[model samples]
Target: MSCSEDPTCQELLDHIYELVDADEDAIDERSRALLAAHAAVCPSCRDAVDAERHVRELLRRCCGESVHAPAALRVRVVSMTTRVRRTE
Candidate 1:
């Protein structure tokens, strides 16, 4: 069951980040369907989606294919930051 009768442009835009990170999370099927349908007819949204996809791809390629840090590295970084304070 979809929350919205049809995904509005605003709704799609708001969730665009989720769409870009689609593989990272299980976005609902209804929302995914709506995004696909809307992008087909909405040039603005299609362009935005394309740009977001491109940026994500580039980042993946440049960052060695994983957007997230490896678990071991993350643990080390977190421990090191325990005493560091953010200045900005």
Candidate 2:
């Protein structure tokens, strides 16, 4: 189902990415149901789910530790946040 047709579908799509590393058999019924339903009706979501899984697997293989933001990127983000907060 298109996200516009069912808002829950988009939430389900998002949840699919979150659940990728979780134990499939241990996943809650609600998530499993959403995944099953979405995969059945939405090729785009299915592809998204597959792509996310592949990326996660690749990351796991290439980087055992979680990725960290570069110091420069972190400083830039902090500066941007500070400016935004000041403006607000």
Candidate 3:
């Protein structure tokens, strides 16, 4: 089944954040299937997800270790993110 037959565009985008955040554990099997189906048809979303994965891989290779984000930086990021609303 394709995205249209299963997940709608909005549904795919909603789950895409988990993919972009590299939160594989957070994504359920259903979301993964929907994403795979969407990727088969939507080249733009597929390209974007691929790019995000590549960037994450590059960061991992460059750092070779996870760095703890400062509490203040985290707070600032959270505050900024909260100030903005997701647009469809």
lDDT of each: 0.72, 0.64, 0.67
lDDT of 3 by residue, 1-88 (tens): 1234476656666566675664555566666776767867888778867877798788888887566679999789867754563432
Cα displacement (angstroms), candidate 2, residue 2, comes to: 19
Q: Number of the top candidate by lDDT?
A: 1
lDDT of 2 by residue, 3-87 (tens): 2224255666555644565545435656666565666678887777788879878888898767777999978986885577469
Clash number for every model? 0, 0, 0
Winning model by TM-score: 1
Candidate 3 Cα misplacement greater than 4 A, ranges? 1-16, 22-36, 86-88
Structural RMSD, model 2 = 8.4
Q: What is the lDDT of residue 30 in candidate 3?
A: 62
Better of 1 and 2 by TM-score: 1
Model 3 whole-model lDDT (C-alpha atoms): 0.67
User: Ranking under lDDT, best-scoring first?
Assistant: 1, 3, 2
- 17 in model 2: Cα distance from truth in Å? 2.8
For candidate 2, what is the total of clashing residue pairs?
A: 0
| Backbone clashes in model 1 | 0
